[model samples]
Target: MNTTSKSKADTIAKLREKILLMQGFKPAGAMHKRITGLMPVEQAFPNQVFPLGAVHEMISEGPEGAAACGGFLGGLLGTLMADAGICLWISNSRSLFPPALELFGASPHRIIFADLQREKDVLWATEEALKCEGLAAVVTELNNITFAQSRRLQLVVEKSHVTAFIWRKDPVYLSNTTAVARWKIAPAPSISEPGLPGVGFPHWQVELLKVRNGIPGSWEVTWSEGRFHTHDETVRKLVSVRNDVQKTG
Candidate 1:
């Protein structure tokens, strides 16, 4: 490339980084600081990294779907809080079981749960929590959120650099919002070891429905050993068989 072309390219690259930073993502150079267990899934994002300090919307249709979504978020929270960080969870319904978080590697004590009486109260608490730079992340449950409300949350996080996750269980309407990404998580059959007893690890069909400046895709993932794993049927079967043979021998 010519010198003038190279100079222009560098300027454009820097501009893109600045834009992403404003949108709550670190630049390409800082890709190492990303949520773990999101391997190929992260490739769909701009610079192959998930955006922190922004709002992420997750939708679920039924009770089972909501449970799966909560479990998945818990798994991510485990990593986010690995550094002794604190998180706030605001919800009116109080469907999430705080004790269950231990299965996903997050200590229930590290998350402060705000069980409000009204949805508006949940939203209010979420916004306030997002504005707190001392918090690592904020998660709120609501049936719907207006674009303006989401935009305000986005602005708060941009300045505070705190990540926010919005879980909409059985939402009446899915409207346009300022959320950086939209996800849908559904319950999938748990993988069981051969010759073993009852249920196994939690599994989910994870879908990235939409992302700003990124690709949308679907993936089957499981929460095993306290982390997210891109589920592979073949690998599971082989491991199960191998373990069973060893037990028999």
Candidate 2:
């Protein structure tokens, strides 16, 4: 390409980055530096970065699916908490085993879990927690969420820059939400080495059902070596993305 053409391309790229950043996406350059484990999936997002300062919605079929979704979220939490910031988990019917999070690289002490009996209480706590700038992330469980409720959460995160994950446990109807992305996770068979005796690494079939301005696809991801490892059984291509978890001094 000629110099004029090259200059024009660069200008457009820079402008695009600025627009994406304003829309709550990190820059393309930052994606390579900060994203871990899910590079290919992350590329499907605008600006090739995970959407921070926004809410993500996840739905599951039953208890098993819900557990799988939680495990997937655990991996994300590990990365988000790399800076030593605390995470808040609010749920109405909580079944997560906090001790098991060690397998996903999250310290149980860094997570504060609140179990409430009413959905309203869970929503209230979740919204209040998201408003706290000191928090790294917040995960909430709800059977259903309205567009307005999700929109409110999105607005709160935009100002606080805290990520939020909404877990919809067996909702009867899937309605519209203001979430940036919607996901569904199912338990895939575990993988074990030949000499290993116990259950192997946690495997999951992740489906990106809906994303605001990104392509939707499916992949199998495994949590091992303190990071996410993406691979497909049929293709057998293993992609190890950069580890962005903050290192302690």
Candidate 3:
């Protein structure tokens, strides 16, 4: 074959490989399916539970609280994506802290942060990003969002099979809605030794205020070194002290 013909054939082959990856046409079936049967929660979601490929909404009272919630959720989503997919962050007010996020298994490089000015623009851009077949998940921050807009986002996520996370500045009062899960995160107790302490940030208290197919109510979670885990009573006391310091400071 001539040089030009050979080059053309190679290019075509690369294109075909790219197409296959986008379609998830692997030689073997999905690994998740094989192990999911052993997990009850995974069965409940049917569409991949927790932060995997499911639409979730997180609402916080203020920017500081929202940062904690966002970082924790980002890590969860990042851990789910691992090296196989990318996480999109569409923010209007705050920027994602790379070092903090990296602790949760999100690679700073894999995160794509986009700053948008208007609420409508943020929603529009988020919708477009969710439609991308290549992304593992998309997370967006919006100061205001309506039920109708949320429903539209849900439709796009369902169609594309991409997980969407919406973070709002304040609580959204939707009597009836289509969100798969709704979470409210707050500053909880810190996990630290009471007497043997250096200066560090406070931990978090996460509550699953609403979940479509899962149990809801309070869930105590602590954050440290970019990782989130369940908080025990001992850690809870530490967090209480930390909370006091924060309040006084």
TM-score of each: 0.85, 0.84, 0.70
lDDT of 1 at 120: 82
**Residue 61 miss distance in model 2 (angstroms):** 1.9
Segments of candidate 3 deviating more than 4 angstroms: 1-48, 172-176, 199-202, 224-227, 232-249
Specify the poorest-scoring 10-residue window by lDDT in model 3.
33-42
What does candidate 3's lDDT look like per residue over 1-249, in tens digits? 699999999999788767744533322235442221113323333233443444677878777787778666765676557766787889878655766766666777887888888877888999999888799788888766777888888778767878788886675564445677677778753455556677444456666667664566565665555555565566567667778877998
- Candidate 1 — which pairs collide? none
Candidate 1: residue 50 Cα off by (Å) = 1.6
After superposition, which runs of candidate 1 have C-alpha atoms over 4 Å from their true positions? 1-22, 28-32, 232-249
Ranking by lDDT: 1, 2, 3
User: Highest lDDT among the candidates is held by which one?
Assistant: 1
> Where does the lowest 10-residue lDDT sum fall in candidate 1?
27-36
**Stronger candidate by lDDT (1 vs 3):** 1
Tens-digit per-residue lDDT, 1-249, candidate 2: 699999999999899878876777776554333447788788778876888768999888888998898889988888888779799999988899998887786788999999899998988898999999899889998989988888889889888988899999998889999899999999986766545568878889989999987899888888888888777543242212111211321
lDDT of 1 by residue, 70-169 (tens): 8999988887787898989998887888899889878899999888998788888888899899987788998899999999998888888888999999
